[model samples]
Target chain A: MIPNIFRLTLPILFGYVPLGTAFGVLFATQLDYAWWLAPLMGVVIYAGAGQILAVSLLAAHAGLLEVFVAMLVLNARHVFYGLSLLRQFRGAGLKKLYLIFGLTDETYSLLTTRPRGGSPQEEHRTDVAITFANQIYWVLGCAIGALLGRSVEFDSTGIEFALVALFIVLAIEQFKALGSQKPLWMGAAAAGLALALLPPAQQLIGAIVMVTAALLLQYNLQRNTTLTREANHD
Target chain B: MTEPMYLAAFIAVTALATFLTRVTPFVFLSRHSEHPLLQHLGQFLPAAVMTLLVIIFLHRSAHWSAPTFGLDAIGPALVVVVLHLWKRHALLSIAAGTVCYMLVQQF
Candidate 1:
């Protein structure tokens, strides 16, 4: 289990380190914020989307309420993640706090696939391990970024695309595994439609609504398919 | 752009709002069994979340106003996507994307 945890987490650590470092460097150089602030925000916020939004909001002179609303819309999916893991995380003890706090997207992807006994204790251990691994990677990345930002003179422009690519890869992997074109089509339609409907600031909200609607549509379709299969079997 | 005090206030309030959004669901929901509806929503949440994220990236530059339909971004994004699909590697995709972005930014 120890080895498995390390193996599972190594990829994420490597990816996050440079990404976090770039962010730290960017914040330090561009925003002139303190170095520690980068890592602190990384750990606490942990949402790349939110961090980027924060920077843009800060740049645009957006109000506090606007920033808050934007973040809520961007991160609203986390509520569903927390809900799904409730049963799996029921008895986590002190780790319960960490499990909840550290339920980032990467951690969720890792934990959902981790092999464990059906027992609550085993599930809790897996959750804690996953959470610990994810946070450690993020912090290490931030530290590297802070140090590099101060010392290194190399151009770090365009480094942000690493994260964008990472998410795209993950999404593609999920799509392949699920073998469902419906969800993909739905997402594409919803996003395109939302882009048309919402202004720049409210795009996030429109996207959320569209995605939710797509999910509902997919759910209904899946239900109908299952019923037909059962009827055929009967 | 503003005074130090305002910056400090901004960070503090932002921190509070961010923390609550992340921490609240875990604290309140972790103790309960997964509800049927929650489970239903959970299965699709990742896809939904990923879709939102992708849209944000594609639209990050505001619109496809560029002459080539964001070819600067789309070209590199396509490269990154292909590399990742083939290699199933995150680091490689990132490296490819960064190199491509830098190369494109110059021309």
Candidate 2:
């Protein structure tokens, strides 16, 4: 059972291992501990980009409230991930709580877009295993990298481009899955507008709220127009 | 002296906040709401957020002074975009892009 989980998490293993190593190295060099907090954050925080940002924040002696708010902004997308998976998680029992807690971006994408199969019981089991395996891979990476902290001689710069590519691929796939270009383009427009107008720190939430408001307006307008036309027709 | 304490507090608070982001929707929305608005946000928000995220990376990855758009990062970024569009493989595209960027940086 565990082996199956490892096999399924193979792709994430590639991404997580290296990325977690980067996080670990950064944490060790930049933060309070050279070895400890890597795995601790991996287990407790488990946020990828947010954790990276946290290292920078903590290194800068950011206040606790600042750290909290910055992380909240960095992780805002997670709320949407949880919302999407709400139905799938219904009555998932104690495991359901785990699922909610484990809803990282990569995990959410894989589970939500995964091809469904087997009985519900089998599926849930697979999910639990996958989550466990992915996080374990991450923790392992952090531990290994933290132990090897700051001793390596190599250029690891721009390695984070992989994450950029991952998000692009994910966005494209999500766009394809939705099969509606309207929301996506509008989203792009909203983001561009926000980026132009707001501070970098403020842009994400601004874009999200703008997109949400635009979508709501679009939906309401379409509904009202359809209703009006139907009344006239009748 | 208090640095360690502050660090611990920072980690705990951030962890709690992160946990809430993941759990609150499930806890609260699952109880009182099945509204289409929530449903729509779930469906469409990811693509939008991800698009913005990519934009953020693109903006951060380079500091272009000339509008000519230097080949510094764009060449590899374009590689990623094209590879993803053509091959539709996430890991493959990411690997290719990272390799391309690393190679470019060597120059």
Candidate 3:
């Protein structure tokens, strides 16, 4: 039955392995570190964009604080991923730690949207299976690409665009599930504002902050309106 | 680059910072799972966050100053969206979009 998880994770396997390979190739070619470090970071860091970003940062000889802050901002969206899964992950047990650790953008999207199993135990098992499967694909891909890095001579210029494609697909799925475009519009406005105002490194965090504030304000107004409507009915 | 020995420390710090971001909400909000605010955020946050991520990624990947003026990215992005809306297949959309992007970028 373990292989059953592969069926569920096939798309992610396709996504992570190639993306991880891209990271591995970049790491091998860009940094002074050994090729092995590419897969090592894949195992420990487990974030595609963050790992890719680290390649440039390390190449530039960035300090620990700089790497830390950059990674935190780049991954700030993960905070909300955990928030969305709090109830679903309640009985995940020891795997819960791994779950949180492995909550990349793709994993979180899959977890939120994948159909639940028959029971909580079954669901937790599926969750762990999916999470573990994705990481293995990523690490394996990283190892392959690192080994091939020096020998390969092809251009990898636009391969990272796979990530953009992945996110676009996920965005569409989220829209279908949520059945509203307000969030999309809000996101576009906030991201546009951030792009115009912030530097490249700061844009993600700026967009997150603006979107979060707008969401909170919208949520409060919605609650108040609902309360008022209930009172009028009474 | 700096000494190779410092690389380990850098990796350690990066992993910790990323973990903290993913874990912070669960650490602070697990006990408040049933709170109305948490519930509301849970209901809508995924959609909003996903949208934000998509926009940010598209913006980051584009080159607004280039002669192509971001078409390399925007064209493939549109293909991803349109193809997914039509086919509703994730892998197909991503593969097609990536190929489209590579073509535009290289040629």
User: Which candidate achieves the best TM-score against the true structure?
Assistant: 3
Say which docking band candidate 1 falls in: acceptable
What is the per-residue lDDT of model 3 for residues A100-187, given as tens digits with 9 covering 90 to 100?
9999887887787766657988888888889999999999989878888867677656777877787787778878978988887887
Model 3 regions lying over 4 Å from their true place: A1-11, A56-70, A154-157, B1-5, B65-67
Q: Evaluated on chain B only, what are the TM-scores of all the candidate structures, in order? A: 0.74, 0.75, 0.82
Candidate number achieving the greatest DockQ relative to the actual structure: 3
lDDT of each: 0.67, 0.76, 0.84
| DockQ of candidate model 3 | 0.63
Pairs clashing within candidate 3: none
Worst 10 residues of 1 chain A by lDDT: A109-118
Compose the digit string of candidate 2's lDDT tens values, residues A1-234: 776666556667766887898888888877657487788889998888878888888878887788888788777867667766776677678898778778887787667666666777778878888888889888888887788788857766666566666767777887888887776688778878987999977776687778778877877887789899999999
Per-residue lDDT of candidate 1, residues A85-176 (tens digit): 66666656788777767777677666654445667887788678768877877877776777677676666556556556655666676677
Put down candidate 2 lDDT per residue, B1-107, tens digits, no spaces: 38778877888988898998888788778864467776776677666766766676666666477653546677777888899889887778878888887776665
Candidate DockQ values, in order, are 0.39, 0.57, 0.63
| Least accurate 10 contiguous residues by lDDT in model 2 chain A | A2-11
Query: lDDT score of model 2?
Result: 0.76
TM-score of 2: 0.84
